[model samples]
Target: MGTNRWKKYKIEMLPIKEPTEIEELSLENLVDQILNAKKLDPNADTTALEREIDQMVYQLYELTPEEIKIIEG
Candidate 1:
Protein backbone atom coordinates (compact mmCIF):
# COMPACT_ATOMS: atom_id res chain seq x y z
CA MET A 1 0.00 0.00 0.00
CA GLY A 2 1.08 3.57 -0.58
CA THR A 3 2.22 5.50 2.45
CA ASN A 4 2.09 9.15 3.44
CA ARG A 5 5.58 9.68 2.04
CA TRP A 6 4.09 11.21 -1.05
CA LYS A 7 2.53 13.93 1.06
CA LYS A 8 5.95 15.15 2.12
CA TYR A 9 6.79 16.26 -1.38
CA LYS A 10 6.56 20.03 -1.71
CA ILE A 11 4.19 21.59 -4.17
CA GLU A 12 3.46 25.16 -5.17
CA MET A 13 1.11 27.00 -7.49
CA LEU A 14 2.24 28.42 -10.81
CA PRO A 15 1.80 31.94 -12.02
CA ILE A 16 -1.10 32.21 -14.46
CA LYS A 17 1.01 33.80 -17.17
CA GLU A 18 3.43 30.88 -17.32
CA PRO A 19 0.78 28.28 -18.13
CA THR A 20 -0.85 30.63 -20.60
CA GLU A 21 2.49 31.29 -22.29
CA ILE A 22 3.20 27.58 -22.68
CA GLU A 23 -0.15 26.70 -24.17
CA GLU A 24 -0.43 26.19 -27.95
CA LEU A 25 3.22 26.94 -28.51
CA SER A 26 5.60 25.42 -31.05
CA LEU A 27 7.55 22.30 -30.02
CA GLU A 28 10.79 24.22 -29.58
CA ASN A 29 9.07 26.87 -27.53
CA LEU A 30 7.31 24.18 -25.54
CA VAL A 31 10.61 22.64 -24.61
CA ASP A 32 11.92 26.03 -23.61
CA GLN A 33 8.88 26.70 -21.50
CA ILE A 34 9.18 23.33 -19.75
CA LEU A 35 12.79 24.00 -18.89
CA ASN A 36 11.97 27.46 -17.64
CA ALA A 37 8.70 26.58 -15.90
CA LYS A 38 10.34 26.28 -12.49
CA LYS A 39 12.31 29.44 -13.11
CA LEU A 40 8.99 31.21 -13.47
CA ASP A 41 8.00 29.86 -10.07
CA PRO A 42 10.41 27.93 -7.90
CA ASN A 43 7.59 26.46 -5.85
CA ALA A 44 5.34 25.77 -8.85
CA ASP A 45 2.95 22.81 -9.03
CA THR A 46 5.39 20.29 -10.43
CA THR A 47 3.04 17.31 -9.99
CA ALA A 48 0.52 18.91 -12.31
CA LEU A 49 3.32 19.78 -14.67
CA GLU A 50 4.49 16.18 -14.61
CA ARG A 51 0.99 14.93 -15.35
CA GLU A 52 0.78 17.44 -18.17
CA ILE A 53 4.00 15.99 -19.54
CA ASP A 54 2.61 12.46 -19.26
CA GLN A 55 -0.45 13.57 -21.18
CA MET A 56 1.80 15.07 -23.82
CA VAL A 57 3.72 11.84 -24.12
CA TYR A 58 0.57 9.78 -24.37
CA GLN A 59 -0.69 12.03 -27.11
CA LEU A 60 2.62 12.02 -28.92
CA TYR A 61 2.72 8.24 -28.96
CA GLU A 62 -1.00 7.78 -29.42
CA LEU A 63 -1.08 5.44 -26.46
CA THR A 64 -4.23 4.40 -24.64
CA PRO A 65 -4.77 5.03 -20.95
CA GLU A 66 -4.25 1.33 -20.21
CA GLU A 67 -0.94 1.37 -21.97
CA ILE A 68 0.12 4.41 -19.98
CA LYS A 69 -0.93 2.72 -16.78
CA ILE A 70 1.22 -0.29 -17.55
CA ILE A 71 4.14 1.89 -18.47
CA GLU A 72 3.81 4.02 -15.37
CA GLY A 73 3.42 1.08 -13.08
Candidate 2:
Protein backbone atom coordinates (compact mmCIF):
# COMPACT_ATOMS: atom_id res chain seq x y z
CA MET A 1 0.00 0.00 0.00
CA GLY A 2 2.94 2.31 0.64
CA THR A 3 5.17 1.47 -2.29
CA ASN A 4 5.23 3.21 -5.67
CA ARG A 5 6.79 0.47 -7.77
CA TRP A 6 3.50 -0.49 -9.40
CA LYS A 7 3.08 3.08 -10.63
CA LYS A 8 6.21 2.76 -12.73
CA TYR A 9 5.27 -0.66 -14.08
CA LYS A 10 5.12 -0.59 -17.90
CA ILE A 11 3.04 -3.66 -18.62
CA GLU A 12 -0.43 -3.20 -20.08
CA MET A 13 -3.25 -4.01 -17.71
CA LEU A 14 -5.25 -7.02 -18.84
CA PRO A 15 -8.58 -5.25 -18.59
CA ILE A 16 -7.46 -2.37 -20.78
CA LYS A 17 -5.60 -4.34 -23.40
CA GLU A 18 -6.75 -5.00 -26.97
CA PRO A 19 -5.88 -8.30 -28.63
CA THR A 20 -5.19 -9.41 -25.12
CA GLU A 21 -2.05 -11.19 -24.03
CA ILE A 22 -1.74 -13.57 -21.13
CA GLU A 23 0.77 -12.72 -18.46
CA GLU A 24 1.18 -15.53 -16.02
CA LEU A 25 1.76 -14.31 -12.52
CA SER A 26 1.12 -15.43 -8.97
CA LEU A 27 -2.08 -14.45 -7.17
CA GLU A 28 -0.08 -12.11 -4.97
CA ASN A 29 1.24 -10.31 -8.01
CA LEU A 30 -2.21 -10.03 -9.50
CA VAL A 31 -3.64 -8.65 -6.28
CA ASP A 32 -0.80 -6.21 -6.00
CA GLN A 33 -1.44 -4.95 -9.50
CA ILE A 34 -5.15 -4.63 -8.81
CA LEU A 35 -4.57 -2.72 -5.60
CA ASN A 36 -2.03 -0.53 -7.27
CA ALA A 37 -4.49 0.24 -10.06
CA LYS A 38 -7.07 1.20 -7.48
CA LYS A 39 -4.56 3.41 -5.77
CA LEU A 40 -3.68 5.07 -9.02
CA ASP A 41 -7.28 5.46 -10.05
CA PRO A 42 -9.67 5.82 -7.19
CA ASN A 43 -12.67 6.07 -9.51
CA ALA A 44 -11.86 2.79 -11.25
CA ASP A 45 -14.65 0.27 -10.90
CA THR A 46 -14.32 -3.55 -11.05
CA THR A 47 -17.23 -4.81 -8.96
CA ALA A 48 -18.95 -6.82 -11.67
CA LEU A 49 -15.67 -8.43 -12.65
CA GLU A 50 -14.97 -9.26 -9.02
CA ARG A 51 -18.29 -11.03 -8.68
CA GLU A 52 -17.67 -12.88 -11.93
CA ILE A 53 -14.31 -14.02 -10.66
CA ASP A 54 -15.81 -15.09 -7.35
CA GLN A 55 -18.40 -17.15 -9.14
CA MET A 56 -15.74 -18.72 -11.31
CA VAL A 57 -13.65 -19.59 -8.27
CA TYR A 58 -16.62 -21.08 -6.47
CA GLN A 59 -17.50 -23.12 -9.53
CA LEU A 60 -13.91 -24.22 -9.90
CA TYR A 61 -13.91 -25.54 -6.36
CA GLU A 62 -17.46 -26.87 -6.64
CA LEU A 63 -18.46 -24.97 -3.58
CA THR A 64 -22.05 -25.21 -2.46
CA PRO A 65 -24.46 -22.27 -2.26
CA GLU A 66 -24.21 -22.40 1.51
CA GLU A 67 -20.44 -22.41 1.23
CA ILE A 68 -20.57 -19.45 -1.12
CA LYS A 69 -22.65 -17.45 1.35
CA ILE A 70 -20.32 -18.37 4.17
CA ILE A 71 -17.20 -17.59 2.16
CA GLU A 72 -18.62 -14.38 0.74
CA GLY A 73 -19.88 -13.30 4.09
Best by lDDT: 1
Report the C-alpha displacement of residue 69, candidate 2, in angstroms.
Answer: 0.7
User: For model 2, what is the alpha-carbon lDDT of residue 50?
Assistant: 64
- Tell me, by TM-score, which candidate is best: 2
Q: For residue 24, what is the lDDT in candidate 1?
A: 42
lDDT of 2 by residue, 6-59 (tens): 543564453342221332233345557667778999777867556655665666
The 10 consecutive residues of candidate 1 with the worst lDDT sum are: 11-20
Locate the minimum summed-lDDT window of 10 residues in model 2.
Answer: 17-26
- Which stretches in model 2 have alpha-carbon errors above 4 Å? 1-40
Steric clash pairs (candidate 1): none
In order, the Cα lDDT scores of the candidates are 0.62, 0.61
What TM-score does each of the candidates earn?
Answer: 0.44, 0.44
